[model samples]
Target: MDPLHPTVDPARFAPTLDAGATFEEYEALKAILLAGSAQFDVRAVGEVHTARPSFPLYTASIGSRDPQAPAVGFFGGIHGLERIGTQLILHYMRALLFRLEWDELLHQQLQKVRLVFMPLVNPGGMWAQKRANPHGVDLMRNAPQRAESGVPFLAGGQTLSPWLPWYCGRPGAPMEVESAALLQVVHDELASRPFSLALDCHSGYGFDDSLWFPYARTRRLMAHLPEMFALKTMLEQSHPHHAYSFEPQSNQYLLHGDLWDHAYDHAPPDHVFLPMTLELGSWLWIRKNPRQLFSRHGIFNPIKAHRIKRVLRRHADLLDFLTRAAFAAPRWLPPADRRMQLQQLATACWRPRRAP
Candidate 1:
């Protein structure tokens, strides 16, 4: 399914930051940063400057930082309007922090795994309440790779103008500041480990929430297809009835400059980097509250207080499942002798079959 990205009035999306606007999410993030600093190794990755205030891009990590330790990263807010995605990460962080005070089992798990978070990557865009950042660039599409063919018009990234949505910056231009910062975080924190998994949260798509793996730039299988399927099987066996459509982003549509694809490609050939996006379906939200269609923020976020809570509460298990999977990756990952069998299973389950 496509975003069916609703266009607000042209004047409302004039590609400028609302300097006077305050971002409640950024402020809440700071509070959480302070509260968790005692346990988390927190630091600013970069700073996003607007006309008046500059938001500090932050990353907080905990657990083992050992080079060999498996790592899991939880990221959100790459698109400003998807506040629910950011909230989900923040909720996971807050809950994890509260549990650390007494949950001994979690602490033991942390010792074996590294957990990192970049919950609010596009605060400036979020502050301005626009999907694109202040420069009007879609960070998800800012990577250097191009879709050689078969990309839908504007939805797959464009260069018509910054005024247009999903506008990738001018050709040959460097990535946006937020996009670069996120990539740097991925390289420094996630790819350094031998086994790592990154989940970047997003919303504003189909009816059922989805778990999309990479190769968004094409319909081919990812390099680590066997490992990806192994992880999927672990989740399904553990959760039994979780509500997620696990598939490749290409299964929905092809797109250009998918950052995760770049990140997965850039990882050292020996490393296993599995990046998945949790696209929380917002059409369901819009259906339940038809009035949401009129507002851009409402289109990507849950407007009602209760629905917002429901959205946040349900995803914590997924996050927890990831850390557990990472901690026990060596155990669940198929042996060299079994990789071919797992790959065959993965292809059967995910690869689209051609009509005879």
Candidate 2:
């Protein structure tokens, strides 16, 4: 059976974020979530200034009933042009909220797992539909990943030139406002309740859905291979079209101080294994007929639309699985080993050429 044809209401699966939509739309969505009830908490992380104007960086949390339940976070829109990421999170939220209303199973899962949605991490960059922030700094690459001279290269990578889209900012200066804000929020939240799993959504990639873990250099991350493999299998079974692959790091053709990298590095050792970047597909931004008039951001492309629906459904399944696995296991798998096996399986699914 094709997973895309599930009998859920399409309207319930629709995204709250519109393509090429303004910051006002995002604020509107935030407002809606905030006014709903005490179950959700909507707050501003900070603000970013763009050529057009400045906008708030927002984070929304759907508090779980269980205090000790593992936290799950979904983040997107780090790259301004990558609107699909934001849409994916919105779609997931919609499905989750819908299910929570009618399904006891879903309600149980929600009570067991806290979910934090950072739907638009780079609102200023997203507003212009550009990759970098208004200052032309690629927030992903601006992380303090490496050291220079005798100090950390904290603000060194933000410099912009005519040659590239990813301009890391000036050395010793604060990183882009967006990245700094997200980092602070995530850090504080995790410090209190560590996350068991996280999915940072992105698009404009290969045809298959790819899940990338920590950089290959981080050998310690190899421990969580089993859990990652199980999660990928569950996702594939729930939504078959999503071809699952795992890459250790960004390709040489596409390298940066990506958000996932920073997230994994900062998370607790056991929690570190849970971070994965879900790269959807190249088809997300274009339709079957390239010339056919459609949303410039292609938010409504028919093929992409179906894929989004499928992913949202699968995400629901994944959420249930996570709740069961985290609480049921007598002894949870260690982080490093589980990650290695996940990388192995993902290599087979994503990079068949490199499959052993």
Candidate 3:
């Protein structure tokens, strides 16, 4: 579904942050950070200023400070309307805090891997229940990368107007503050490690949930295809009937300025960085409750409490799986001798078509 053809009326998106109006989700997120401050290092990486107030962009981490340990990042709320994405990461962080008090094994696991959290990246947009930041730029589409060809009009990206959806920022302009802050966090933490994984959660797409890897700017296979295939093999072997579809983002559609693509492109070759986006399927929610199509927020998030709880539970194990995968990457990552075999398998699975 190209967001270029919005399901709901456009006027419904015109709301802005009003005087002293607090974003309840942001307040709840801050409380979670404060409660875990004793266990984690929490600091504001940047701030997004709106007409009403300036919201702090925070990056929190806990685990070994050693540069040799593997790292994993949990990111969400890049699109403000996708509130479930932000909530899921917070739920995981809160669970970690509770476990920190009693789970000795969790502490042992932390020593082997560094876990970083930036649960709410676009607070200004989230504050207004809009997908784009306060400057009206979609953080996911605000990066500097561009597609070569065959990109859908407006859907791939554009600078036509901020009033339209999927607006990539003006040509040659600096990245939005939130986007830059995320890149800095990736550089400071994930890219510095020998092996790392990042998962950025989102919703409002197809009928089933999808796990999309890098190369949103192009359909060409990433240099780390074998590693990606190895990861997929591990998941399938571990969960034979897992519900999520694991594939490349370009398989569904292409876009400009995908942050994960930008990060993978910039990371050092010696270090392996695998970034994936968890695009939860809101269409399922709407299928059960057809009226959701009329509400902008409903189109992107579960509108009911019970449904929201189910959505949270569905992705919990996957998050834990990713954490463990990063911690144990050395055990499963393909050795040089096996790289060609796995690469061949990956090509057969992901890029099956050939030119005539």
Candidate No. with top lDDT: 3
Q: Would you list the rank order by lDDT, best first?
A: 3, 1, 2
Residue 300, model 2: lDDT of: 26
- What are the clashing pairs of model 1? none
Q: Write the per-residue lDDT of candidate 3 for residues 22-92, one digit (tens) a residue.
A: 57678777677667656667768899998777887987788877788899999999998999999999999
- Give the Cα-based TM-score of candidate 2 against the true structure: 0.72
Q: In order, what lDDT does every prediction score?
A: 0.86, 0.59, 0.87
Positional deviation of residue 216's Cα in model 1 after best superposition, in angstroms:
0.5
The residue-by-residue lDDT of candidate 1 on 241-334, one tens digit each, is 9999999888888788899988988999899999999999999999999999999889999999999999888999999999999999989888
All candidates: TM-score: 0.93, 0.72, 0.93
Question: Candidate 1: global Cα-lDDT?
Answer: 0.86
**Candidate 2 on 185-260: residue-level lDDT in tens?**
6666542454366677777665565677765223233445566666656556756764456554433122345555
In model 2, the number of clashes is 27
Candidate 2 lDDT for residue 8: 25
lDDT at 80, model 2? 76
